[model samples]
Target: MAGYTVIDFETTGLSPRYGDRIVEIGVVKVSHEGEVYDAWSTLVNPQRDVGASRIHGITAKDVLTAPTFDDVAPALLDAVAGRIVAAHNASFDMRFLAAELERVGYVVGERTPPSVCTMRWSGAFLPGSSRRLRDCCASAGIEIVGEHSALADAFATAQLLASYLDRCGGRPMWGDEISAARAFRWPAPRPAAHTLTYKVRADRQPERADGWLDRIVARMPRSADSRVDSYLAVLEMAMLDGYLSLHEQDQLVEAAQSSVLSRPQVLALHAEYLHAMAAVALEDGILTADERSELDRAAACLGLAQHDVDDALAGAAGDDGADGLVISGISLTVGDRVTFTGEMRMERSVWEARARAVGLQPAGLARSTKLLVAADPDSLSGKASKARSYGVPIVDEAAFAKLMDRLEASAD
Candidate 1:
């Protein structure tokens, strides 16, 4: 075997075609003469949010300043260039690898060095045992220190590849699988494939969205102005990393029902939510990979039948500013879900009491929440960050108190 590169990817989900992406990658290269080169591994800024943080232990803070895929692609190309590519599940890694590479204007072919999965080959030599990475590693007595960490998994996989080489010798047993793997290449991009959206088949138009359940949901505590806030909170988190799990989808549907929105209203809210998230993603000018992932997740969850998430992305990529949510220009009212953040002229308790005295109904930090009263509009508190993410504007406490006084006078 010529010098080879063993790779591993920690991703947001299972499929790149469906918007799942690599948040991190590790590549270890071994020379043709069995000498290992320096290992290459790094956290990537997915630009939206990291997915499955528990499994990978990568947080938004961890990748906040990490290099983007385009920034590191040249170095990655050097690692994989002219080397046999190996992975525990080579297809998974290659799928992400190929997708990431193509997105940055480099289309890779399989013939140059070829790709192979150790899991496929392991079944031939080690029967009766499962082919999971750790299982195969365990069969070979190869301990995986950090099972899902891109670097550790890549290292462990490197050892497993060496073991497979020893057991199978020069004439490996799995010829057909190996050959198929060697020939696999991502298909060339279709004309304007990147721009064309495979529009999601809008669901069967429901006969009636305003049923008894709708009434009950509508009767639920939505803002006096609109129920949009309730949905956006759930939607923003759902698409933060570009892919929504089935569990999240169910939760969103249930939450939508509780909001008393009919099926049509639910769909309409989904569109608005998509635009808001898009605006957030585009706040940084160039939409980062994580942001793209989120747009894809939103499109999928919102029942958009677009094949190309880039379309959703394109719609949101305008100069929307990075000031968080921008509800400043819209008409808002007193009972339309309001809350307070930051230190204010009066104590929070006092402010709340006074506001309530004037018949101003207060709500929590929710999506449909109309206004936020802050001591400092520029406070970087967690609550402020959330308000920005949900596109709610922050009006300082002094402003709020003045408004409350005006309301009291008007009432009298």
Candidate 2:
């Protein structure tokens, strides 16, 4: 038996062949006896937009001030050097690992280092179990508190490797691979200038980092004209999934700068937008859990506090009524063309039929497509990527339902 370094990487996308980069890396060292030794993880600044954030929960903002891959490469190499490297799906992790290492000028001799793929070996150990990390962990009764974060997944993989070792009964299932790893020599690591700006995912942090909204506000002048509809329209589209992506933030900032909207004007518009969402959430004389969640997301993106939602709900109840079901920028109408991507909770045919019921054309994704309703709004599928490139608004299933509700309400 040999010690192992279990690794996991959260990348910008699936393949490095498509120009995707790594945004985070986690490593866990375990002793030959399958005892946990050390665990480490860091958010890497990919220096590009974080792709498929919905899948990994890593946002561009999360890595904005973090160390770049080059900055962390030496530390990462030190962790895996002279150890039997392992991962759940070792091939996928190795692909990105090799790419990143090569980019940073670290070579592992003439061949890729031997790796133990827990997923590939799952059938041998946990027979009849699925290969997904979460699924396999569940089968082994190993709890993975964080599914997508790099460190959490790496630690889980380490435990999974330990389970496989326990099943080996003093023998090594991957003895040949371990022997090969012992002979594998890693390139000398280049020293990196240490940076003090590491960041955990927002949910784990006590305070949310000042994000896109704050940056845009800081750039705004004091007393410009209140031509806010243009900016507000862009804001509506940006927050369709209740997540203001980096690309969408760029769009909003451009709109604000172009229209010369002042700091006070933009702040006022955000307040109004929050109030409008609160009003709609209260339209039925009750705030459902879903509506409350939607309002919270809107407030967070708009840089408003939760108390703002409470205040807005109070003010809305005092008013005669809400004008209509307002969900910021969503306003689907008759003859509007909408499309969908990824798997929806409802059947594709069913959602298309519902779209057609409200006089919307359930069409294929194209530049002319008015909206793209995705199961995961940050979907990395071809259609979703194309829609983002084409500047099409992408919303999740719930937001699509809200759009349908608004359309049906208008008809009524």
Candidate closest to the true structure, highest TM-score? 2
50-125: candidate 2 lDDT, tens digit per residue = 9767657787788988888888888888888878899876756776788788887777554656688786566557
- Candidate 2's error at 165, in angstroms? 0.9
lDDT of each: 0.59, 0.70
Q: What does candidate 2 score on TM?
A: 0.49
Error of 2 at 330 (Å): 49
Question: Which ranges in model 1 have alpha carbons more than 4 Å from their true place?
Answer: 31-37, 109-114, 172-244, 247-412
Write the residue-wise lDDT of candidate 1 on 1-412 in tens digits: 3456889887765555556667777888755444456786887777766867755667777777677776667667666655577887565566678778777787666332347667645644554334356666777888987666788888888887777666656444444344544454434333332322111111222133333222212212111112344444345435544457786677566556543456765665555445555655555566767556656655776787555455545655643422212231233345666888776777888877776776666768989876788776545577866886686767665446545655677878
Tell me the lDDT of candidate 2. 0.70
TM-scores for every predicted model: 0.43, 0.49
